[model samples]
Target: MIKAKQIVKKFESGTNVLFAVNHVDLIVPKGQFITITGRSGSGKSTLLYQLGLLDKPTSGDIELAGRDVINMSEDERTFYRLSKLGYVFQDYAILPSLTALENVLLPLLMLGLPDADARRMATDAMVRVGLEDKLINYPSQLSGGQQQRVAIARAIAHDPEILFADEPTANLDTETSDMILELFLKLHKEGQTIVMVTHEKDYAEKADRIIELADGKIVRDETLRRN
Candidate 1:
């Protein structure tokens, strides 16, 4: 679980101060799927980055699993992120030169997993994402959806406690996007905590809760009932 209190992320322009995320307080429970939705410049992505520890807020407190992370050192934050968090970005973020299996294997290896164990975990992740046949394929050879799946495989190979996705379906077609969302939903059902930022209303509806923001402030936080 994660908690944020009075989080404010500010940026200084030439003569103006911009609030990327202003006075935001949120709590994400374990085994929950939450989506942050807003129009462009609404601070949705900024808020995601802050919660993911990819960026620090100007002022606020963030507690991850009851540990204060707002003031963690760079090395500590890096270690924590690698060990406890997973991320999927809009851009796929796959290494073009690496095969799908290798891409997923790299992160597991970084965790000090032995080669055999990492290989097994990476292959299982690829299979879970329906990319087993394409494991040996390079990113350039795979379709956009396949590439994104590879990215997801890499993120989940280590089985982190939380998954953070930013506009994960932004570049995919409708069918492909649906496929990806289904995969995410499956993961959520299996008890993976997820926090995603997206502009698509339809995708947001699939989450357990949706937090709508405007002008860097959360205007509505709605918990949707699932059948």
Candidate 2:
């Protein structure tokens, strides 16, 4: 779960201040699948970065599962991010030299889990993403969708409480994109809390909630009913 209040992320552009995210307040409950959508410069990805703890807001408060995270030390933030959050980006972000299983296990190893434990978790995560057969393959050997699945596996290896994805299917073909979305839906049905930023309206509509942003502000926040 996340709660943000009056989040302002401003940048100095020459003499003018550009507000990428201006006074945005957002709440994402546990087990919810939410999509943030907007045109270029609309601040959807900027908002996601703030919520994902990848960047700090210039002025605002963010609570992640009830802990105040905005003021945490960098070291503390790193540990918390490793422990509680998972992330996927438009780029696969997979290491080129590492095998799929190795990539998935590295984060768990970084978390200080024993090798055996990390290995087990990593394999399970790969399986969850339908990549069990491709564990030994490197990013170069896999298809774009498979590589993305490996990235997802890496993110979920530690069983993170929140998964943040930014244009996760941007590089894939339509069929592959649909495959990724279906995987996300399956995970959500099993209680994963996902917050994804996408420019595609069809993908956004599949979520439990859709948030539309314009010029750094929320213009439409709609919660869709699931069957």
Candidate 3:
């Protein structure tokens, strides 16, 4: 569902150019669970941002569901991102003042859905993440795991074709991380496409395929047999 060819992303601070993602080529098939693994400064997050269209690449191309991103207009890019891509971040990017249900419904609001339908979808998503009881809870009231689950619910509430997770388990305990992984696997089995960035080897091993990066380049690509 996503492809990148010789993608390069660089940042200029004064006179120095730092290549965060250097000539990285990646392909993630539909309905597949793929993990991107790397150390700090290895370009994993940059690559994810590029794939999600949160950041523009300096060079090369990104194709999502067959359309080249570089060819899209600014408004088209925004619409595409709003309707087709879902993002989950390590820091649990839930709105501090909004309750869990409201946060999940935010994407639907962006789509201009009616309030009733938005609430229905948001409730379903929260239930999917086992957070139905926390619907009225704000970010400050939920634990890290609960907050991350809320983020996941919000990300997928729109039923995006692709889900992008950056360091999804970074802040959760091992048990909670395992539960989240199980939820991801369940979604994957039901044909949800996922691209997750993770530092934990155990989580990486659970994916159908693992892509490792170092020094802004892919160092290893392996398909793991399901046990």
What tens digits encode model 1's per-residue C-alpha lDDT throughout 1-227? Answer: 99999999999989999999999999988888999999999999999999999999999999998889998999999999988999999989999889999999998888899999999999999999999999899999999999999999988889988999999999999999999999999999888999999999999999999999998999999999542
Q: 117-225, model 3: which lDDT tens digit per residue?
A: 9999999999999998999998999999999999999999999999999999999999999999998998888789999999999999899999999988999999885
**Residue pairs with backbone overlap in model 2:** none
How many backbone collisions does model 3 have? Answer: 0
Question: How far in Å is the alpha carbon of 220 misplaced in model 3?
Answer: 0.5
- What's model 1's lDDT at 133? 99
For candidate 1, the 10 contiguous residues with the lowest summed lDDT are 218-227
Order of candidate numbers by TM-score, starting with the best: 2, 1, 3
Q: Candidate 2, which segments miss by more than 4 Å at Cα?
A: none
Quantify all predictions' global Cα lDDT against the true fold. 0.94, 0.94, 0.92
List candidate 3 segments past 4 Å from native: none
lDDT value, residue 115 of candidate 2: 95
Q: How far is candidate 2 from the true structure (C-alpha RMSD, Å)?
A: 0.9
Q: Give per-residue lDDT, candidate 2, residue 118.
A: 92
* Number of backbone clashes in candidate 2: 0
